[model samples]
Target: MNKVPMTVAGEAALRAELEQLKKVDRPRISKAIAEAREHGDLKENAEYHAARDQQSFAEGRVMDIESKLAEAQVIDVTKIPPTGRVIFGTTVDLINVETEEAVRYRIVGEDEAEVKSNRISVTSPIARALIGKEEGDTVIVRAPGGDVEFEIDQVQHI
Candidate 1:
């Protein structure tokens, strides 16, 4: 499998979730299943079915996280010397060319992309346009609305 690029923080978050699922959620679900089994009538017991469903979901998540971790190429941007170039795990500040509105974004893995937090996937159009560009460089992003231009104000390896 191809290695997936992930930031240090992103990797840490996945590890935490995996640990929780394995240590807490898995055991809790197992206990629930056992208790539901004692209630009798497995064919009609809603609690048993629900517990089984939860177990399936939790186990699937564990496998997914483990696979991702196995293929993850964790990058610690903070350890890299800042060169003003936008790269994976780097936080970038952008200024709209026309409106002069400033926005910040951190390029991260697909699993870690959250627009509300200004963390964008590396494959996103904006991040694709920004990657390899240096601060003070102008980039044109083809958004669904239209083509928008932005000026890179700053790039931080944080």
Candidate 2:
């Protein structure tokens, strides 16, 4: 499996989730399954079916998280050298040339991309265009509506 890029914060979140699933969710589901089995008729038991479904989902997620952690390549943004050029984990402020609308986005790993928080994936079209660019550089991004030009206002490492 290929190594997956994840920020320090993202890694922490995943670890916490994994811990919760193992220590809490796993035991809870086991208890539920035991109680469901005590009801006796497994042939048409709704409780058994529901508990089994939950157990399947919980176990799948535990495995998935473990796999991701095993292949994760955690990146510490603060340790990277500042070159005034955009790189992974850089927060960039941009201005649309045509619309004059300003937006700020932090280029992060795929796991940390959340548009509501102004974080975009590094592989995204806009972030790809902005990568390696310095302040005041104009970058054209291919969008669904056509190509959109954006001027890099600032690059902040946070």
Q: Give each model's clash number.
A: 0, 0
Instruction: Give the TM-score comparing model 1 with the true structure, all chains together.
Output: 0.98
State which candidate has the highest TM-score.
1
In the range 23-132, model 1's lDDT, one tens digit per residue, is 99999999999999999999999999999999999999999999999999999998889888999999999999999999999999999999999999999999999999
Residue pairs clashing in model 2 are: none
How do the residues 1-158 of candidate 2 rate in per-residue lDDT, one tens digit apiece? Answer: 79878888889999999999999998999999899999999989999999999999999999998988899889887898877899888889999999999999998889889999999999999999999999999999997889999999999878
* lDDT against true structure, model 1: 0.97
Please report how far candidate 2 places residue 53 from its true position, in Å. 0.7
What lDDT does candidate 1 reach at residue 84?
89
For model 2 the TM-score comes to: 0.95
Off by over 4 Å in 1: none
